[model samples]
Target: MKTYTRITLSLLTILSLSACKNEEITPNRGKVKFETVSISSKLAGRIEKIYVQEGQLVKQGDTLALIDIPEVNAKLIQAEGAITSAQGQLDMAFNGATSEQLSQIDGQLNAAKAQMDFAQESFNRLQNMFQDSLVSQQQFDEVKMKLSMAKAQVSGLQAKRDEVTKGTRFEQIEQAKGQLDRAQGAKQEVLLAADERYVIAPTDMSIETISLEEGELLTPGYALFNGYKTNGVYFRFTIPESRIYDYNVGNTLTIMNPYTKDETQAKIIAIKQLAQYADITSTSPLYELSESIYELKVVPTSDISGQKFFNNATVLIKK
Candidate 1:
Protein backbone atom coordinates (compact mmCIF):
# COMPACT_ATOMS: atom_id res chain seq x y z
CA MET A 1 0.00 0.00 0.00
CA LYS A 2 2.85 2.45 0.79
CA THR A 3 4.53 1.80 -2.59
CA TYR A 4 1.30 2.45 -4.50
CA THR A 5 0.80 5.77 -2.65
CA ARG A 6 4.36 7.00 -3.54
CA ILE A 7 3.87 6.22 -7.25
CA THR A 8 0.52 8.10 -7.37
CA LEU A 9 2.06 11.19 -5.73
CA SER A 10 4.91 11.28 -8.26
CA LEU A 11 2.54 11.03 -11.24
CA LEU A 12 0.41 13.92 -9.91
CA THR A 13 3.48 16.11 -9.43
CA ILE A 14 4.67 15.54 -13.03
CA LEU A 15 1.22 16.37 -14.45
CA SER A 16 1.07 19.66 -12.50
CA LEU A 17 4.46 20.85 -13.87
CA SER A 18 3.53 19.89 -17.45
CA ALA A 19 0.30 21.86 -17.31
CA CYS A 20 2.20 24.99 -16.18
CA LYS A 21 4.68 24.63 -19.05
CA ASN A 22 1.91 24.24 -21.61
CA GLU A 23 0.16 27.34 -20.32
CA GLU A 24 3.35 29.38 -20.65
CA ILE A 25 3.81 28.25 -24.26
CA THR A 26 0.31 29.29 -25.39
CA PRO A 27 0.28 31.77 -28.32
CA ASN A 28 -1.33 35.24 -28.53
CA ARG A 29 -5.06 35.19 -29.14
CA GLY A 30 -7.04 37.15 -31.74
CA LYS A 31 -10.54 37.35 -33.18
CA VAL A 32 -11.77 36.99 -36.77
CA LYS A 33 -13.51 40.09 -38.15
CA PHE A 34 -14.81 41.52 -41.40
CA GLU A 35 -15.75 44.97 -42.70
CA THR A 36 -19.31 45.99 -41.99
CA VAL A 37 -21.41 48.50 -43.95
CA SER A 38 -24.67 50.28 -43.15
CA ILE A 39 -27.54 50.81 -45.54
CA SER A 40 -29.87 53.82 -45.40
CA SER A 41 -32.12 56.16 -47.35
CA LYS A 42 -31.31 59.81 -48.00
CA LEU A 43 -34.90 60.97 -48.14
CA ALA A 44 -37.87 60.56 -45.82
CA GLY A 45 -40.91 58.71 -47.08
CA ARG A 46 -43.10 55.64 -46.70
CA ILE A 47 -41.50 52.35 -47.63
CA GLU A 48 -43.47 51.05 -50.56
CA LYS A 49 -41.57 47.80 -51.19
CA ILE A 50 -38.82 45.65 -49.73
CA TYR A 51 -36.85 43.43 -52.08
CA VAL A 52 -34.56 41.70 -49.61
CA GLN A 53 -34.90 39.64 -46.44
CA GLU A 54 -32.71 39.42 -43.38
CA GLY A 55 -29.56 37.31 -43.90
CA GLN A 56 -29.85 37.57 -47.66
CA LEU A 57 -26.58 38.03 -49.52
CA VAL A 58 -26.83 40.99 -51.87
CA LYS A 59 -24.64 42.20 -54.71
CA GLN A 60 -23.49 45.72 -55.44
CA GLY A 61 -26.05 48.02 -57.09
CA ASP A 62 -29.01 45.84 -56.17
CA THR A 63 -32.31 47.58 -55.53
CA LEU A 64 -33.23 46.99 -51.91
CA ALA A 65 -36.42 49.02 -51.39
CA LEU A 66 -38.72 51.62 -52.85
CA ILE A 67 -40.04 54.78 -51.20
CA ASP A 68 -43.00 57.00 -52.02
CA ILE A 69 -42.44 60.69 -51.36
CA PRO A 70 -45.38 62.97 -52.04
CA GLU A 71 -43.24 66.08 -51.91
CA VAL A 72 -40.92 64.78 -54.59
CA ASN A 73 -43.77 64.04 -56.97
CA ALA A 74 -45.25 67.50 -56.50
CA LYS A 75 -41.85 69.08 -57.03
CA LEU A 76 -41.40 67.16 -60.27
CA ILE A 77 -44.64 68.52 -61.67
CA GLN A 78 -43.73 72.03 -60.60
CA ALA A 79 -40.34 71.68 -62.25
CA GLU A 80 -41.90 70.67 -65.58
CA GLY A 81 -44.22 73.67 -65.56
CA ALA A 82 -41.33 75.99 -64.75
CA ILE A 83 -39.30 74.59 -67.60
CA THR A 84 -42.15 75.16 -70.06
CA SER A 85 -42.67 78.72 -68.94
CA ALA A 86 -38.96 79.44 -69.09
CA GLN A 87 -38.75 78.03 -72.59
CA GLY A 88 -41.58 80.26 -73.77
CA GLN A 89 -39.93 83.31 -72.29
CA LEU A 90 -36.60 82.45 -73.92
CA ASP A 91 -38.25 81.96 -77.31
CA MET A 92 -40.02 85.27 -77.02
CA ALA A 93 -36.75 86.98 -76.20
CA PHE A 94 -34.99 85.45 -79.17
CA ASN A 95 -37.81 85.87 -81.73
CA GLY A 96 -38.89 89.41 -80.75
CA ALA A 97 -42.50 90.75 -80.84
CA THR A 98 -45.20 88.77 -82.69
CA SER A 99 -46.67 89.87 -86.07
CA GLU A 100 -50.08 90.67 -84.58
CA GLN A 101 -48.49 92.94 -81.95
CA LEU A 102 -46.63 94.95 -84.60
CA SER A 103 -49.75 95.33 -86.71
CA GLN A 104 -51.72 96.73 -83.77
CA ILE A 105 -49.02 99.28 -82.98
CA ASP A 106 -49.02 100.46 -86.63
CA GLY A 107 -52.80 100.93 -86.69
CA GLN A 108 -52.69 103.02 -83.53
CA LEU A 109 -49.93 105.21 -84.96
CA ASN A 110 -51.92 105.90 -88.16
CA ALA A 111 -55.05 106.96 -86.23
CA ALA A 112 -53.03 109.24 -83.98
CA LYS A 113 -51.40 110.90 -87.01
CA ALA A 114 -54.80 111.65 -88.63
CA GLN A 115 -56.11 113.20 -85.43
CA MET A 116 -52.92 115.32 -85.12
CA ASP A 117 -53.37 116.68 -88.71
CA PHE A 118 -56.91 117.81 -87.94
CA ALA A 119 -55.82 119.43 -84.69
CA GLN A 120 -52.97 121.32 -86.43
CA GLU A 121 -55.33 122.82 -89.01
CA SER A 122 -57.77 123.89 -86.31
CA PHE A 123 -54.95 125.51 -84.30
CA ASN A 124 -53.85 127.50 -87.31
CA ARG A 125 -57.38 128.84 -87.86
CA LEU A 126 -57.72 129.69 -84.14
CA GLN A 127 -54.39 131.59 -84.19
CA ASN A 128 -55.59 133.67 -87.14
CA MET A 129 -58.88 134.47 -85.32
CA PHE A 130 -57.06 135.48 -82.14
CA GLN A 131 -54.74 137.79 -84.08
CA ASP A 132 -57.68 139.38 -85.99
CA SER A 133 -59.88 139.65 -82.82
CA LEU A 134 -62.58 137.51 -84.54
CA VAL A 135 -63.15 135.48 -81.32
CA SER A 136 -62.54 135.64 -77.51
CA GLN A 137 -59.03 134.85 -76.19
CA GLN A 138 -60.40 132.05 -74.00
CA GLN A 139 -61.88 130.26 -77.04
CA PHE A 140 -58.61 130.43 -78.96
CA ASP A 141 -56.69 129.17 -75.87
CA GLU A 142 -58.96 126.06 -75.61
CA VAL A 143 -58.34 125.15 -79.27
CA LYS A 144 -54.57 125.54 -78.78
CA MET A 145 -54.73 123.20 -75.81
CA LYS A 146 -56.56 120.53 -77.87
CA LEU A 147 -53.92 120.76 -80.63
CA SER A 148 -51.10 120.34 -78.09
CA MET A 149 -52.78 117.25 -76.58
CA ALA A 150 -53.30 115.64 -80.03
CA LYS A 151 -49.64 116.25 -80.98
CA ALA A 152 -48.45 114.58 -77.75
CA GLN A 153 -50.67 111.51 -78.46
CA VAL A 154 -49.24 111.13 -81.96
CA SER A 155 -45.62 111.27 -80.61
CA GLY A 156 -46.38 108.61 -78.01
CA LEU A 157 -47.88 106.30 -80.69
CA GLN A 158 -44.87 106.74 -82.98
CA ALA A 159 -42.52 105.82 -80.11
CA LYS A 160 -44.59 102.65 -79.46
CA ARG A 161 -44.37 101.64 -83.14
CA ASP A 162 -40.59 102.07 -83.16
CA GLU A 163 -40.19 99.95 -79.99
CA VAL A 164 -42.36 97.17 -81.44
CA THR A 165 -40.31 97.04 -84.63
CA LYS A 166 -37.08 96.81 -82.63
CA GLY A 167 -36.05 93.37 -81.34
CA THR A 168 -35.86 92.39 -77.66
CA ARG A 169 -33.30 94.19 -75.53
CA PHE A 170 -29.95 92.44 -74.86
CA GLU A 171 -30.51 92.66 -71.12
CA GLN A 172 -33.96 91.08 -71.43
CA ILE A 173 -32.54 88.20 -73.51
CA GLU A 174 -29.85 87.52 -70.91
CA GLN A 175 -32.46 87.51 -68.16
CA ALA A 176 -34.52 84.97 -70.05
CA LYS A 177 -31.46 82.77 -70.58
CA GLY A 178 -30.74 82.84 -66.85
CA GLN A 179 -34.31 81.83 -66.03
CA LEU A 180 -34.15 78.92 -68.47
CA ASP A 181 -30.92 77.64 -66.98
CA ARG A 182 -32.37 77.86 -63.46
CA ALA A 183 -35.43 75.87 -64.51
CA GLN A 184 -33.30 73.15 -66.15
CA GLY A 185 -31.16 72.89 -63.04
CA ALA A 186 -34.28 72.53 -60.90
CA LYS A 187 -35.55 69.77 -63.15
CA GLN A 188 -32.26 67.88 -62.84
CA GLU A 189 -32.45 68.16 -59.06
CA VAL A 190 -35.96 66.71 -59.12
CA LEU A 191 -34.77 63.82 -61.25
CA LEU A 192 -32.04 63.06 -58.73
CA ALA A 193 -34.60 63.12 -55.94
CA ALA A 194 -36.68 60.65 -57.87
CA ASP A 195 -33.70 58.33 -58.14
CA GLU A 196 -33.23 58.51 -54.38
CA ARG A 197 -36.72 57.08 -53.89
CA TYR A 198 -35.28 53.76 -55.09
CA VAL A 199 -32.90 52.42 -52.50
CA ILE A 200 -29.81 50.83 -54.12
CA ALA A 201 -27.01 48.94 -52.48
CA PRO A 202 -23.71 50.79 -52.61
CA THR A 203 -21.52 47.71 -52.15
CA ASP A 204 -21.53 43.92 -51.86
CA MET A 205 -22.80 43.05 -48.39
CA SER A 206 -25.10 40.70 -46.52
CA ILE A 207 -28.38 42.04 -45.23
CA GLU A 208 -28.36 41.77 -41.46
CA THR A 209 -31.70 43.40 -40.71
CA ILE A 210 -34.86 44.80 -42.23
CA SER A 211 -35.65 47.48 -39.74
CA LEU A 212 -38.91 48.79 -41.18
CA GLU A 213 -41.71 46.83 -42.79
CA GLU A 214 -43.57 47.76 -45.91
CA GLY A 215 -45.89 50.78 -45.47
CA GLU A 216 -43.87 51.98 -42.51
CA LEU A 217 -42.45 55.49 -42.48
CA LEU A 218 -38.70 55.59 -42.99
CA THR A 219 -37.00 58.75 -41.89
CA PRO A 220 -34.06 60.26 -43.74
CA GLY A 221 -30.67 58.77 -42.83
CA TYR A 222 -32.16 55.96 -40.77
CA ALA A 223 -29.89 52.96 -40.82
CA LEU A 224 -30.76 49.37 -41.73
CA PHE A 225 -28.04 47.13 -40.31
CA ASN A 226 -26.02 45.31 -43.00
CA GLY A 227 -23.53 42.56 -42.26
CA TYR A 228 -19.81 42.43 -43.08
CA LYS A 229 -18.44 41.79 -46.55
CA THR A 230 -17.34 38.24 -47.11
CA ASN A 231 -14.22 38.98 -49.13
CA GLY A 232 -12.94 41.62 -46.74
CA VAL A 233 -12.32 39.11 -43.98
CA TYR A 234 -9.59 39.91 -41.48
CA PHE A 235 -8.54 39.28 -37.88
CA ARG A 236 -8.13 41.70 -34.97
CA PHE A 237 -6.02 41.17 -31.91
CA THR A 238 -6.08 43.28 -28.78
CA ILE A 239 -2.59 42.98 -27.39
CA PRO A 240 -1.04 44.69 -24.39
CA GLU A 241 1.24 47.64 -25.19
CA SER A 242 4.21 45.79 -23.73
CA ARG A 243 3.87 42.88 -26.17
CA ILE A 244 3.30 45.02 -29.30
CA TYR A 245 7.03 44.75 -30.14
CA ASP A 246 6.52 41.10 -31.15
CA TYR A 247 4.37 42.03 -34.18
CA ASN A 248 4.61 44.55 -37.03
CA VAL A 249 3.13 45.38 -40.41
CA GLY A 250 4.10 42.95 -43.26
CA ASN A 251 5.04 40.15 -40.80
CA THR A 252 3.66 36.78 -42.00
CA LEU A 253 2.45 34.45 -39.26
CA THR A 254 0.35 31.36 -38.88
CA ILE A 255 -3.00 31.65 -37.13
CA MET A 256 -5.10 28.76 -35.77
CA ASN A 257 -8.78 28.37 -35.00
CA PRO A 258 -9.15 27.46 -31.35
CA TYR A 259 -12.08 25.08 -31.77
CA THR A 260 -11.21 23.48 -35.12
CA LYS A 261 -7.43 23.68 -34.79
CA ASP A 262 -7.26 24.66 -38.45
CA GLU A 263 -4.26 26.81 -39.34
CA THR A 264 -3.88 29.51 -42.01
CA GLN A 265 -1.04 31.88 -42.91
CA ALA A 266 -1.83 35.63 -42.57
CA LYS A 267 0.18 38.78 -43.09
CA ILE A 268 0.09 41.71 -40.71
CA ILE A 269 -1.61 44.50 -42.64
CA ALA A 270 -1.94 47.24 -40.05
CA ILE A 271 -1.24 48.04 -36.40
CA LYS A 272 -3.06 50.90 -34.68
CA GLN A 273 -3.30 51.96 -31.07
CA LEU A 274 -6.74 51.92 -29.53
CA ALA A 275 -8.36 55.17 -28.55
CA GLN A 276 -7.68 56.47 -25.06
CA TYR A 277 -11.34 56.12 -24.12
CA ALA A 278 -11.67 52.68 -25.72
CA ASP A 279 -12.00 49.58 -23.54
CA ILE A 280 -10.53 46.28 -24.68
CA THR A 281 -10.24 42.75 -23.26
CA SER A 282 -6.77 41.16 -23.27
CA THR A 283 -5.78 37.51 -22.95
CA SER A 284 -4.56 38.29 -19.46
CA PRO A 285 -5.34 41.32 -17.31
CA LEU A 286 -1.91 41.50 -15.75
CA TYR A 287 -1.10 44.99 -17.14
CA GLU A 288 -1.90 48.28 -15.41
CA LEU A 289 -5.41 49.66 -15.76
CA SER A 290 -4.12 52.79 -17.55
CA GLU A 291 -1.83 50.88 -19.90
CA SER A 292 -2.49 51.48 -23.59
CA ILE A 293 -3.97 48.77 -25.84
CA TYR A 294 -3.27 48.18 -29.54
CA GLU A 295 -5.26 46.57 -32.35
CA LEU A 296 -3.39 44.38 -34.82
CA LYS A 297 -5.02 43.67 -38.19
CA VAL A 298 -4.10 40.62 -40.26
CA VAL A 299 -5.32 39.21 -43.58
CA PRO A 300 -5.03 35.63 -44.76
CA THR A 301 -2.48 35.06 -47.51
CA SER A 302 -3.36 31.39 -47.93
CA ASP A 303 -6.55 30.09 -49.47
CA ILE A 304 -9.21 30.00 -46.72
CA SER A 305 -11.87 29.00 -49.24
CA GLY A 306 -12.96 25.74 -47.61
CA GLN A 307 -12.72 27.00 -44.06
CA LYS A 308 -15.80 28.60 -42.49
CA PHE A 309 -15.34 31.27 -39.83
CA PHE A 310 -17.64 33.84 -38.34
CA ASN A 311 -16.95 37.42 -37.42
CA ASN A 312 -15.36 37.81 -34.01
CA ALA A 313 -14.51 34.09 -33.74
CA THR A 314 -11.60 33.21 -31.54
CA VAL A 315 -8.25 32.70 -33.30
CA LEU A 316 -4.80 32.14 -31.91
CA ILE A 317 -1.54 33.55 -33.29
CA LYS A 318 1.18 30.90 -33.62
CA LYS A 319 4.66 32.27 -32.94
Candidate 2:
Protein backbone atom coordinates (compact mmCIF):
# COMPACT_ATOMS: atom_id res chain seq x y z
CA MET A 1 0.00 0.00 0.00
CA LYS A 2 2.88 2.48 0.70
CA THR A 3 4.45 1.69 -2.68
CA TYR A 4 1.12 2.46 -4.43
CA THR A 5 0.76 5.81 -2.60
CA ARG A 6 4.34 6.83 -3.50
CA ILE A 7 3.75 6.18 -7.23
CA THR A 8 0.50 8.27 -7.24
CA LEU A 9 2.30 11.24 -5.59
CA SER A 10 5.08 11.12 -8.15
CA LEU A 11 2.58 11.26 -11.05
CA LEU A 12 0.76 14.28 -9.52
CA THR A 13 4.04 16.11 -9.04
CA ILE A 14 4.99 15.61 -12.70
CA LEU A 15 1.55 16.94 -13.86
CA SER A 16 1.90 20.04 -11.62
CA LEU A 17 5.36 20.86 -13.05
CA SER A 18 4.06 20.52 -16.63
CA ALA A 19 1.14 22.87 -15.89
CA CYS A 20 3.50 25.52 -14.51
CA LYS A 21 5.72 25.40 -17.57
CA ASN A 22 2.74 25.88 -19.91
CA GLU A 23 1.49 28.74 -17.74
CA GLU A 24 4.81 30.57 -18.17
CA ILE A 25 4.02 31.06 -21.87
CA THR A 26 0.31 31.79 -22.26
CA PRO A 27 -1.32 32.10 -25.69
CA ASN A 28 -2.23 35.66 -26.75
CA ARG A 29 -4.94 37.29 -28.78
CA GLY A 30 -4.18 39.58 -31.76
CA LYS A 31 -6.00 42.65 -32.92
CA VAL A 32 -8.91 42.78 -35.35
CA LYS A 33 -7.66 44.87 -38.22
CA PHE A 34 -8.62 45.78 -41.76
CA GLU A 35 -6.24 47.09 -44.39
CA THR A 36 -5.97 50.89 -44.44
CA VAL A 37 -5.62 52.76 -47.71
CA SER A 38 -4.71 56.35 -48.55
CA ILE A 39 -7.31 58.57 -50.10
CA SER A 40 -5.81 61.26 -52.34
CA SER A 41 -6.40 63.44 -55.36
CA LYS A 42 -4.54 62.96 -58.64
CA LEU A 43 -4.72 66.71 -59.27
CA ALA A 44 -3.88 69.33 -56.69
CA GLY A 45 -6.76 71.59 -55.74
CA ARG A 46 -8.41 73.58 -52.95
CA ILE A 47 -11.03 71.88 -50.86
CA GLU A 48 -14.50 73.15 -51.61
CA LYS A 49 -16.53 71.01 -49.21
CA ILE A 50 -16.16 68.12 -46.79
CA TYR A 51 -18.93 65.55 -47.02
CA VAL A 52 -17.79 63.24 -44.25
CA GLN A 53 -16.57 63.51 -40.70
CA GLU A 54 -14.26 61.21 -38.81
CA GLY A 55 -15.81 57.77 -38.18
CA GLN A 56 -18.32 58.00 -41.00
CA LEU A 57 -19.01 54.85 -43.03
CA VAL A 58 -18.38 55.16 -46.77
CA LYS A 59 -18.52 52.83 -49.78
CA GLN A 60 -16.24 52.55 -52.74
CA GLY A 61 -16.37 55.61 -55.06
CA ASP A 62 -18.25 57.63 -52.46
CA THR A 63 -17.51 61.33 -52.46
CA LEU A 64 -15.69 62.27 -49.29
CA ALA A 65 -14.74 65.81 -50.25
CA LEU A 66 -14.93 68.23 -53.13
CA ILE A 67 -11.90 70.04 -54.53
CA ASP A 68 -11.98 73.11 -56.74
CA ILE A 69 -9.47 72.90 -59.57
CA PRO A 70 -9.41 76.29 -61.26
CA GLU A 71 -7.14 75.09 -64.00
CA VAL A 72 -9.47 72.25 -64.91
CA ASN A 73 -12.46 74.53 -65.47
CA ALA A 74 -10.43 76.76 -67.74
CA LYS A 75 -9.13 73.77 -69.63
CA LEU A 76 -12.66 72.51 -70.21
CA ILE A 77 -13.68 75.81 -71.73
CA GLN A 78 -10.67 75.80 -74.05
CA ALA A 79 -11.34 72.21 -75.05
CA GLU A 80 -14.93 72.95 -75.97
CA GLY A 81 -13.92 75.92 -78.10
CA ALA A 82 -11.36 73.82 -79.93
CA ILE A 83 -13.98 71.16 -80.64
CA THR A 84 -16.39 73.72 -82.09
CA SER A 85 -13.74 75.32 -84.30
CA ALA A 86 -12.56 71.94 -85.55
CA GLN A 87 -16.11 70.90 -86.39
CA GLY A 88 -16.63 74.04 -88.44
CA GLN A 89 -13.40 73.47 -90.35
CA LEU A 90 -14.37 69.85 -91.07
CA ASP A 91 -17.76 70.96 -92.37
CA MET A 92 -16.16 73.52 -94.65
CA ALA A 93 -13.87 70.85 -96.08
CA PHE A 94 -16.82 68.56 -96.80
CA ASN A 95 -19.09 71.29 -98.32
CA GLY A 96 -16.56 72.85 -100.73
CA ALA A 97 -16.89 76.52 -101.89
CA THR A 98 -20.21 78.40 -101.88
CA SER A 99 -22.14 79.33 -105.09
CA GLU A 100 -21.35 83.04 -104.70
CA GLN A 101 -17.60 82.33 -104.56
CA LEU A 102 -17.76 80.23 -107.73
CA SER A 103 -19.66 83.01 -109.57
CA GLN A 104 -17.09 85.65 -108.52
CA ILE A 105 -14.18 83.51 -109.69
CA ASP A 106 -15.86 82.91 -113.11
CA GLY A 107 -16.35 86.66 -113.53
CA GLN A 108 -12.63 87.30 -112.89
CA LEU A 109 -11.69 84.67 -115.42
CA ASN A 110 -13.94 86.27 -118.11
CA ALA A 111 -12.39 89.69 -117.51
CA ALA A 112 -8.90 88.18 -117.86
CA LYS A 113 -9.89 86.63 -121.22
CA ALA A 114 -11.15 90.02 -122.54
CA GLN A 115 -7.86 91.66 -121.58
CA MET A 116 -5.90 88.88 -123.30
CA ASP A 117 -7.85 89.42 -126.55
CA PHE A 118 -7.28 93.21 -126.59
CA ALA A 119 -3.55 92.76 -125.90
CA GLN A 120 -3.24 90.19 -128.71
CA GLU A 121 -4.82 92.62 -131.24
CA SER A 122 -2.46 95.43 -130.15
CA PHE A 123 0.55 93.10 -130.39
CA ASN A 124 -0.41 92.18 -133.99
CA ARG A 125 -0.73 95.87 -134.90
CA LEU A 126 2.64 96.65 -133.31
CA GLN A 127 4.23 93.71 -135.16
CA ASN A 128 3.12 95.24 -138.49
CA MET A 129 4.32 98.69 -137.42
CA PHE A 130 7.73 97.29 -136.45
CA GLN A 131 8.06 95.52 -139.79
CA ASP A 132 7.22 98.86 -141.61
CA SER A 133 9.67 100.76 -139.35
CA LEU A 134 6.75 102.78 -137.98
CA VAL A 135 7.52 102.09 -134.28
CA SER A 136 10.56 101.51 -132.05
CA GLN A 137 11.64 97.99 -130.90
CA GLN A 138 10.94 99.04 -127.35
CA GLN A 139 7.25 99.76 -128.22
CA PHE A 140 6.87 96.28 -129.79
CA ASP A 141 8.45 94.64 -126.78
CA GLU A 142 6.11 96.56 -124.40
CA VAL A 143 3.01 95.24 -126.24
CA LYS A 144 4.39 91.70 -126.20
CA MET A 145 4.88 91.83 -122.39
CA LYS A 146 1.28 93.02 -121.84
CA LEU A 147 -0.09 90.09 -123.86
CA SER A 148 1.98 87.59 -121.85
CA MET A 149 0.79 89.07 -118.53
CA ALA A 150 -2.88 88.85 -119.65
CA LYS A 151 -2.43 85.23 -120.73
CA ALA A 152 -0.84 84.29 -117.41
CA GLN A 153 -3.69 85.97 -115.47
CA VAL A 154 -6.29 84.00 -117.48
CA SER A 155 -4.51 80.71 -116.74
CA GLY A 156 -4.32 81.51 -113.00
CA LEU A 157 -8.03 82.40 -112.88
CA GLN A 158 -8.97 79.17 -114.70
CA ALA A 159 -7.02 77.09 -112.16
CA LYS A 160 -8.66 78.89 -109.24
CA ARG A 161 -12.14 78.21 -110.74
CA ASP A 162 -11.37 74.50 -111.11
CA GLU A 163 -10.21 74.18 -107.49
CA VAL A 164 -13.31 75.91 -106.12
CA THR A 165 -15.60 73.66 -108.17
CA LYS A 166 -13.70 70.43 -107.34
CA GLY A 167 -14.20 70.83 -103.56
CA THR A 168 -11.49 70.25 -100.96
CA ARG A 169 -8.53 67.98 -101.68
CA PHE A 170 -8.32 64.49 -100.10
CA GLU A 171 -5.37 65.54 -97.97
CA GLN A 172 -7.23 68.59 -96.71
CA ILE A 173 -10.23 66.50 -95.71
CA GLU A 174 -8.05 63.97 -93.92
CA GLN A 175 -6.30 66.78 -92.06
CA ALA A 176 -9.60 68.24 -90.98
CA LYS A 177 -10.82 64.87 -89.72
CA GLY A 178 -7.64 64.41 -87.72
CA GLN A 179 -8.05 67.83 -86.15
CA LEU A 180 -11.60 66.99 -85.07
CA ASP A 181 -10.44 63.74 -83.51
CA ARG A 182 -7.67 65.54 -81.67
CA ALA A 183 -10.10 68.12 -80.33
CA GLN A 184 -12.47 65.45 -79.07
CA GLY A 185 -9.61 63.64 -77.36
CA ALA A 186 -8.55 66.84 -75.66
CA LYS A 187 -12.07 67.40 -74.40
CA GLN A 188 -12.14 63.88 -72.96
CA GLU A 189 -8.85 64.52 -71.18
CA VAL A 190 -10.25 67.71 -69.68
CA LEU A 191 -13.33 65.88 -68.46
CA LEU A 192 -11.18 63.26 -66.73
CA ALA A 193 -9.30 66.03 -65.01
CA ALA A 194 -12.59 67.55 -63.89
CA ASP A 195 -13.50 64.19 -62.31
CA GLU A 196 -10.48 64.53 -60.01
CA ARG A 197 -12.28 67.37 -58.26
CA TYR A 198 -14.02 64.89 -55.98
CA VAL A 199 -12.03 63.14 -53.30
CA ILE A 200 -13.32 59.58 -53.40
CA ALA A 201 -13.13 56.47 -51.25
CA PRO A 202 -11.25 53.57 -52.80
CA THR A 203 -13.10 50.89 -50.84
CA ASP A 204 -15.77 50.37 -48.25
CA MET A 205 -14.29 51.89 -45.11
CA SER A 206 -14.84 54.17 -42.18
CA ILE A 207 -13.34 57.68 -42.39
CA GLU A 208 -10.38 57.94 -40.05
CA THR A 209 -9.54 61.59 -40.67
CA ILE A 210 -10.07 64.74 -42.71
CA SER A 211 -6.62 66.15 -43.30
CA LEU A 212 -7.69 69.51 -44.70
CA GLU A 213 -10.55 71.88 -43.98
CA GLU A 214 -12.61 73.72 -46.53
CA GLY A 215 -10.71 76.13 -48.82
CA GLU A 216 -7.37 74.51 -48.02
CA LEU A 217 -5.14 73.05 -50.67
CA LEU A 218 -4.76 69.27 -51.00
CA THR A 219 -1.63 68.10 -52.77
CA PRO A 220 -1.17 64.83 -54.56
CA GLY A 221 -0.35 61.60 -52.65
CA TYR A 222 -1.77 62.66 -49.29
CA ALA A 223 -3.32 59.95 -47.17
CA LEU A 224 -6.79 60.35 -45.76
CA PHE A 225 -6.40 56.78 -44.25
CA ASN A 226 -9.99 55.76 -44.64
CA GLY A 227 -10.38 53.21 -41.86
CA TYR A 228 -10.09 49.50 -42.61
CA LYS A 229 -12.44 47.90 -45.11
CA THR A 230 -15.57 46.47 -43.51
CA ASN A 231 -16.10 43.49 -45.80
CA GLY A 232 -12.44 42.58 -45.82
CA VAL A 233 -12.15 42.24 -42.05
CA TYR A 234 -9.17 40.26 -40.79
CA PHE A 235 -7.05 39.90 -37.68
CA ARG A 236 -3.30 40.45 -37.31
CA PHE A 237 -1.57 38.72 -34.41
CA THR A 238 2.04 39.37 -33.46
CA ILE A 239 3.63 36.30 -31.95
CA PRO A 240 7.12 36.38 -30.57
CA GLU A 241 9.57 33.69 -31.64
CA SER A 242 9.09 31.98 -28.27
CA ARG A 243 5.41 31.25 -28.96
CA ILE A 244 5.41 31.11 -32.77
CA TYR A 245 5.52 27.29 -32.80
CA ASP A 246 1.73 27.23 -32.25
CA TYR A 247 0.98 28.82 -35.64
CA ASN A 248 1.78 28.16 -39.28
CA VAL A 249 0.28 29.53 -42.54
CA GLY A 250 -2.77 27.22 -42.67
CA ASN A 251 -3.48 26.48 -39.02
CA THR A 252 -7.05 26.85 -37.82
CA LEU A 253 -7.91 28.46 -34.51
CA THR A 254 -10.92 29.80 -32.66
CA ILE A 255 -10.75 33.55 -31.99
CA MET A 256 -12.78 35.07 -29.19
CA ASN A 257 -14.04 38.62 -29.63
CA PRO A 258 -13.22 40.47 -26.42
CA TYR A 259 -16.00 42.96 -26.96
CA THR A 260 -18.80 40.53 -27.79
CA LYS A 261 -17.44 37.38 -26.16
CA ASP A 262 -18.42 35.55 -29.35
CA GLU A 263 -16.02 32.99 -30.79
CA THR A 264 -15.34 32.49 -34.47
CA GLN A 265 -13.18 29.94 -36.20
CA ALA A 266 -10.47 31.57 -38.30
CA LYS A 267 -7.81 30.16 -40.56
CA ILE A 268 -4.30 31.53 -40.64
CA ILE A 269 -3.73 33.24 -43.99
CA ALA A 270 -0.12 34.30 -43.76
CA ILE A 271 2.92 34.36 -41.46
CA LYS A 272 5.72 36.87 -41.74
CA GLN A 273 8.69 37.71 -39.52
CA LEU A 274 8.47 41.38 -38.59
CA ALA A 275 11.63 43.35 -39.35
CA GLN A 276 10.90 46.43 -37.27
CA TYR A 277 10.51 46.38 -33.51
CA ALA A 278 8.23 49.44 -33.53
CA ASP A 279 5.66 47.52 -35.61
CA ILE A 280 4.94 45.10 -32.83
CA THR A 281 1.39 45.58 -31.53
CA SER A 282 0.98 42.30 -29.74
CA THR A 283 -1.12 41.84 -26.67
CA SER A 284 1.43 40.90 -23.98
CA PRO A 285 4.38 42.16 -26.05
CA LEU A 286 6.74 39.99 -24.00
CA TYR A 287 9.26 42.85 -24.13
CA GLU A 288 12.36 40.77 -24.71
CA LEU A 289 15.57 42.66 -25.46
CA SER A 290 16.44 41.61 -29.01
CA GLU A 291 14.35 38.57 -29.88
CA SER A 292 12.69 38.57 -33.34
CA ILE A 293 8.88 38.56 -33.61
CA TYR A 294 6.48 37.23 -36.24
CA GLU A 295 3.04 38.30 -37.51
CA LEU A 296 0.20 35.94 -38.25
CA LYS A 297 -2.59 37.07 -40.59
CA VAL A 298 -5.94 35.32 -40.07
CA VAL A 299 -9.39 35.49 -41.62
CA PRO A 300 -12.75 34.11 -40.55
CA THR A 301 -13.77 30.77 -42.00
CA SER A 302 -16.78 30.54 -44.30
CA ASP A 303 -18.81 28.75 -41.70
CA ILE A 304 -18.54 31.78 -39.41
CA SER A 305 -19.70 34.93 -41.23
CA GLY A 306 -21.60 38.22 -40.73
CA GLN A 307 -19.61 39.32 -37.68
CA LYS A 308 -18.89 43.06 -37.60
CA PHE A 309 -15.46 43.53 -36.09
CA PHE A 310 -13.82 46.79 -35.15
CA ASN A 311 -10.22 47.78 -35.70
CA ASN A 312 -7.66 47.05 -32.96
CA ALA A 313 -10.28 45.22 -30.96
CA THR A 314 -9.03 42.30 -28.88
CA VAL A 315 -9.62 38.78 -30.17
CA LEU A 316 -8.37 35.75 -28.35
CA ILE A 317 -6.67 33.11 -30.55
CA LYS A 318 -7.23 29.53 -29.45
CA LYS A 319 -4.16 27.69 -30.69
Best-performing candidate as measured by TM-score = 1
Once fitted onto the true fold, the runs of candidate 1 whose alpha carbons sit more than 4 angstroms away are: 1-26, 114-157, 275-290
Instruction: Report the alpha-carbon TM-score of model 1 versus the true structure.
Output: 0.77
Per-residue lDDT of model 1, residues 1-319, tens digit only: 9999999999999999987766743457888998888778888999999999998888889999999888988998999999999999999989988889888888888888898899889989989988999989999988889889988998998877776578888999999999999999999999999999998888888888788899999998898546667677898988888899888899998888978979889999999998876444354366556668899999999999889888779998875
**Model 2, clash count?**
0
TM-score of 2: 0.75
Report every candidate's CA lDDT. Answer: 0.86, 0.85
**lDDT by residue for model 2 (91-175), tens:** 9999999999898998999999999999999999999999999999999999999999999999999998888788899999999
Model 2 residue 49 CA deviation in Å: 1.2
Give the root-mean-square deviation of each candidate in angstroms: 5.6, 6.5
Best by lDDT: 1
